[model samples]
Target: MSERPHMSSTSWRRSQPITSGFGAGWVLVIFGVLAFLLPPGGTAQQPPDPVPPVGVAPAAVEAENDQELQTIFRSEISFVRVDAIVTDEDGNALVDLTADDFEIFEDDIPQKIESFKLVKHTGVFDPDLPPPGTIRNEFDLEREAAREDSRIFVFFLDEYHVRDYNAMRMMQPLVDFVETQLAPTDLVGIMYPLTPLFDVTLTRNHEQIVHALRQFKGRKYEYDVLNGYEAAYAHYPTTDVEKIRNDVSLSALKALAMKLGGLREGRKSIIVLSEGYTDYVPPQLRDESAGGGGRRGAMRYNPLAGNSRMEESTRLFQDMGMRANLVYTADIANRNNTSFYMVDPRGLAVWEYDMSQVPIDHETDQSMLRILQDTLYVLADESDGRAIVNRNDIGPGLAQIVADQSSYYLLGYTSSEAPTDGEFHEIKVEVNRPDVRIRARKGYYALTEDNATRLMAPPKPEPPSAVSRALAKLAEPTRSRLVRTWVGASRGDNGKTRLTFVWEPIASGQSRRDESASQVMLMAMSDNAAYFRGEVPSRPGGTLPLAEFEADPGELELNVAIEDEYGDVLDRAVDELVVPDFTGTDVALSTPTVLRAQNTMEMRRIAADPDALPTAGRYFRRTDQLLLRGEAYAPGASPVDVTARLLNREGASMMPLPVELSAGGAYELSVQLSPFPRGDYLVEVSAASGDGVATTLVAFRIQG
Candidate 1:
């Protein structure tokens, strides 16, 4: 396998807002997904052997609830969507093309045409929306405003195959593609090959998104200077090249596919930016050693290279309104910036394109900007996106991809393929036209149990309602209300402090329940305000259930923040917890308040509700006949018996003091800071409750 070839859900966000009309689209879906139970000539049913993707199936993946699963099945048909720019041999959007101009294929088999319609982000009520800044939220309704509601575009830039120099060269075309191709409503994210490592930033704002793209260099890791073997240092090798570089990349790819599958809209486009990868010896674990998950035949540099991922990655992309667009490189230039050569196998550059013919755009080429673009056509072609050579001509290729408004046709067909094992098949989309080349999803994974399709079975697709259309333009997640989260602090087995987060769906402020949109989330901040290193998912459906995760107590210190399903942050709570896991220290503190009332000889006494006391008025009379004193105390500490000696500016006692404790040991002390007249009185007391507890007591006067 040429190291260069290839490229590559829903659980985190709710399918749609529930209150919106159930609508007829979902009710009238013609191409209901047909499950291929037994392959064409296969046998009877065998009990599904539970699979723990990482082994320990039971512990790894929670058991599925049949009833709950069924409920999710009946929900709306929320397919993932992908926003694509399909073009012809010429670089022009084929927008005028109709459904018939396209053919649909999956896993190398011809599929029956199902529901097909041209989607665009038009017809809206509210126009003004927030700009894309940073990934402040998970769902950006502004970005979702496009009305197409497509799946995400995950750009997997394979770093293992490309050298740092060539890698730098690819950014030019990518920058142009983002600047011109992506609409204001599109949400683009960049990722490298690794697990739990994603610079996943989402926003509807074009500027913010573009800024993020420019910052994407590549994955940089630091390996231990020592060899990593032996039990002594095996379990937690921070930089075990094999573990960090191999399966992790696969995990990122899987996540990309899942992100597309999770969309509740049309189609998805996942633009990969790397060569591709293959497993090393002993075939790294899949599920179980028995047959385990899928494995590469060898540690092939680029298994599937340009053509491999298109089949499945493209299919998954389409299922979720996603279409794959790969742009990997094939060659590299030396540091001298003088010549070119084949990338060394160990150099880490995977995908390559044909740069034999690259056009130059005036926009780029500033300064002696040393740019070297590698041609990565195989990847781009398979993804149904255009490829380019490094040079000045990237504009034309990118323009073609975004401008491809070709006629799209939706087809559906049933297959006799078995869903038991993960098998690969080939698909071809041919039309009876001369000089016409049809590009569609190569193939999809025949049903795999415990996976997405087999799990919740996407919600039914609903035609965009008037409000849905309006809100789609304004912001996403109009249906998702605020999320109610409870965070607790505790200690882990390692003796380190930990903060646990438990989240549940809350009412979206709208009063109604035909069906409500569940809140899905990707938590960025912990209860203590610390940032998270990995991504956290917030799936909306009630049946999918709430999830709990433990983070280092340090994360909680970031000033707790939460975002709704549409990526809008609705709340920012303070860290009020006193637990060790929350504050990082074992010291807990509190305050209690006390007050006094009085009547004066020369003034009239008044009675009113203490709760209604004017925060700034002195309506009641103070008795100078008696002195008043007050003080504050702390929790688990001695009660401070401090007395306040009342007086005028002349330092004379006015009256005795009365005190009261406020709620939760927190205090607000008040005394008469007014005037008396001809004379004054004095009162005092000094005592401690115990245990070095601090107290607050002061003397003041009322002037005549």
Candidate 2:
């Protein structure tokens, strides 16, 4: 019932370095509405639909066409999954490996090989997956009862800083790092945000990684502020620099991370790919003018935002038992030397404060670039993580990053570093050979994440209920979307009138965009009641275009109350609407008897978008229905062939209407109607579209 993505033409870029501090919320609280545990496996025995968590069932499992739910008792064992990349020491991605070739360790203590499986190649989620009877007891119902012991992710995209050419230069290293340097089972995703096409997607498959990389179009498309992606920035006036740049896209990064945190066995990791002071966000909207004044008129750095963002990025990582590693990227061409081959970390700088403009021109550039090379040493100098600074060795450099992402051993020890009840602890990790580099996260914020993850994770209660889900799915009434409302006046059969409103589909709440998924559920309510209902086949969620929304538009009634994902009723629409039933054999007429209203039957042509309504538009096409009720009725009240006239308010002829009223039925028909000019119009229903039914009279205005 749904469709796919509307691939737009935007590219990704490194965002301007915003310097404020804002943290992410908690993991558990954030994932409150998501599925806590995986569904059950199928058995020959059917069980009472596994009682939904907290009594809540899905709104309605969109029509299931391929599942076999017969006598099988679906086992409800939650499935745990994660993704990673693997590579050998020679900087080559290691493929064709089995689980037997690897070892598992949590907190440094090796654990048993519980489960292993390569991720699927396809990107879509299949309702009929893992097949039935697949869970052979890999789940621990008791352990899950406590909390999800899984991992979370940090999706870092370089949108503003990296230029196109420079970006292309880093692509190979980036991919190599993700595929060869990361672990074979670590979950991670990539996003190159300057372009909208640089969307975020998870890749458990190396093939997917490669495929996505190929789809990367080098040429940038033209963009205007009028289209998508502008509403957020246009309204949020973050004009100051003291704030972080996370809210610009309403990015689900934080939300997505929280959702993934519920996974059964993943680790916590933030894969950062930006080149900055790591997290050196200056406080306040800095006035680059005054050595330290806050941001200028329109652009100021966030005093607390930058540091806060870093704190959030870090704390979020810790809560999920993860650490962050920056695959610090720079132009290979701009490197101190285009060796195009081997290199050493000692030759570079660890933390480069680009003190370039002050004097030492050539000296500064060389020193800064070298400082970048050394930046990794300082990071890896003591911690398990190594910063790949101004890196020249694409193959080995990325291979190292991928290893860290996928298989680098995760070892946690009881920290001797106590809180100052608040104190930063210096963490340290090492491999047997000092000759080879062992990269890992520099430090951890310990319990600082408690507040972070908690704030983000909303409170979890019971699951949803069937009645609730059904109502949630029900699309009812005539919802008027500011941008998609199609309203006009026209006449019907019985010298009566009609108001046809064809609005684009509106869901109960904010709809999540699923690329390429066609089906969507639209719902509406009467401003008069508390229930929600859907019009049409109530198949609001479908793949048809907007033109498909109104086959024969009808309205259903429901409660006026509006609710959100949390089931919390927020507010209600202001005015109540009473709609006529188009289905019943008879309709109550709203016009007076012997109505001499002039009418015209006009055709409404959808010019721009047939399946959509604009928030604002000139009503350019409207068919008017002219009405005149002087046809003498025969004895015994026989049905009359109502001759309706579709005329302009000036009584001028417009279109010839073709409509009818059934025997013994009342109607609102059209004698003749044609599209009206961009303005107000009156509709007069005929005695029928042609026959016995009485006509209706309705009036409405259309905006240009």
Candidate 3:
């Protein structure tokens, strides 16, 4: 085993930072449900439409004839995929162009287009088939999203820049776009400025997406603190706070763009509904006091603004910061092949700020409005998207988004440079025909050396050792957990092994089960001989039972049946356990048990009481804390030092945790789930003595 990472003074385990193709300050958790982990030697399955059949037809009819085909490039470090949408001068899609009519260039050098296909999506599906919204699990969602005819659209509702009135007014237009323009097979999801990209999922359920939009309310200019991020800087002046909001929203947009890019190398659209952003807030509107006192103050003018020169200097300084942020965001969008359709919800606005509160001159207001509109234009133009500003009616622009996705071309080329320097490479696509317009991604970020190797490596073979295979099996149970259980095997009377099983009903919110687990019927068998059988609990969310059974030392096969109170079986599982004789081993460690506490009071009681048994459940919430207890023994009563470390779902080590000695030859460790994201993890405990070392692993999951 490798040396353990230094333990922190805090009880909780420290998080391990993950770097990827995305730019700096982006933390990608290793155990995310959607982590892009491909098998060794196996390439990822691209979307079906990217390799449509070679034929020319009207854009409307080509989508239906898209055949499932793929052009496999030679094993290389990277497969560059670009999505391009060509149109005539009148903004009509040009779908009749062939591969010969287009050219691709990388860093001013023309590159061979290894594969070309005119991809089109009508979002049509069989009426009898269920929509993607019916995806109950992650597998179903991925399957539905990979379909050739499915269109992915994410609504990045930037409430930070949108006012309350504008948010309500724009809600109808967005709803109309989803209900009228989007096909049944289209996958649409809504995200906010603060929404975690890991939690964002594009689904085909249009009704649910629309329902969520109906409740949308913008928080612009509202200083009343809501989340922890806001509370941290609530005391800052309104102007400074607004700058922070812009930083957060822009950072999130860049992160969202990279996330969509990782899903598939197809065209993706993010509808940005906002009133645009500005670096300068008029001095009169900058509230130094909390709760926005300047908005309602009798004296609206800033007393600190003694001269016009000072005001101009401050605005200039702020505008520079805003420009830098906008450039960073545009780079991410271009690299990720995602387009941002900026829809100014304010429509044809005359002023950027309200006169009643801002008290700024009309001339200054007009200039600020123009600056804000230009910011929106730059974002759309750089990402090959359109900015719908200075228009009261945004319905047409919103509809144009659907038309753009209805027909497009997907081009795949292998980069001749293959640079592992981790720098951005520029790409340019052009059409040979005259009087035609072209729009495609500007470029992409090159993969690092480590990332390139991982992508090109083939799938690894399964480990031959039994322990390695058994540890791998632990992650499988997480896929379907009607009842979360914890099993512990220790010494028993008469040379028999003592097996303890504790179980509780997993909350329905955690799983998609309609039937509630009321009782667990357990049957224990050693080879062909029956040992113990009984029902552990009689009700859900009630006190659990620590059911123990004695069995002869050997392999024990246990069958568990999860049933409702009426005896209807909801789920079943067969677990094989090897009961070891502790007395014969020179050094041994008992199976570590976990005890969960909902609050500080419960945690204290669990720690103080030696008789307190570990919870036989594995799933826990973020608000909960945990206490792990186990015992180690060695020959001649030699002392044993125990250590514990956290592991990700793939069995990769994350960080080490502090293990303290408890009374009666036992070891205890405390864990706080608040620092970790919701996912599957393992706690590996090892006991070292003079003669040898003993180890055990326990798997658990944290819920939000």
Best by lDDT: 3
Candidate scoring better on TM-score of 1 and 2: 1
Worst 10 residues of 1 by lDDT: 1-10
Reference-based TM-score of each model: 0.37, 0.35, 0.69
lDDT of each: 0.35, 0.32, 0.72
Clashes of each: 139, 203, 4
lDDT tens digits by residue: candidate 1, 1-704: 00100000001222232222222222212211121222111121224455556645564354453444444342212221122334456533345555575554445544554445554432222246533344443344224523443323445666643445555766666777777676654656666564232234445455655565556554322222223222233333222343445445545554444333333234344455543332221111111211222342232233232233443353233222211211111100000000111112122222222222122222222110111122234334434444444334445544443334222333333443433344434446655445544555444333345543554444455532321222221121223334434333333445444444444444545333223323334343544554343323455333222333445534233233455446554543333333233132222222111122444421122122232111111112344322221223333443444433343323334565554444433223244434454322222333334433222222222333
Candidate 1 vs. true structure, TM-score: 0.37
**lDDT tens digits, residue span 363-441, model 3:** 6677678878888987888777889998889999998898888899988777777666667788899999999888887
Q: Native-vs-model 2 lDDT?
A: 0.32
Which residue pairs overlap in candidate 3's backbone?
40-458, 40-459, 41-458, 41-459
Runs of candidate 3 with Cα error greater than 4 angstroms are 1-79, 126-133, 289-300, 303-307, 416-426, 444-486, 499-588, 593-694, 698-704
Positional deviation of residue 616's Cα in model 3 after best superposition, in angstroms: 6.6
On residues 53-73, what C-alpha lDDT tens digit does candidate 2 reach at each position? Answer: 554445433122113341011
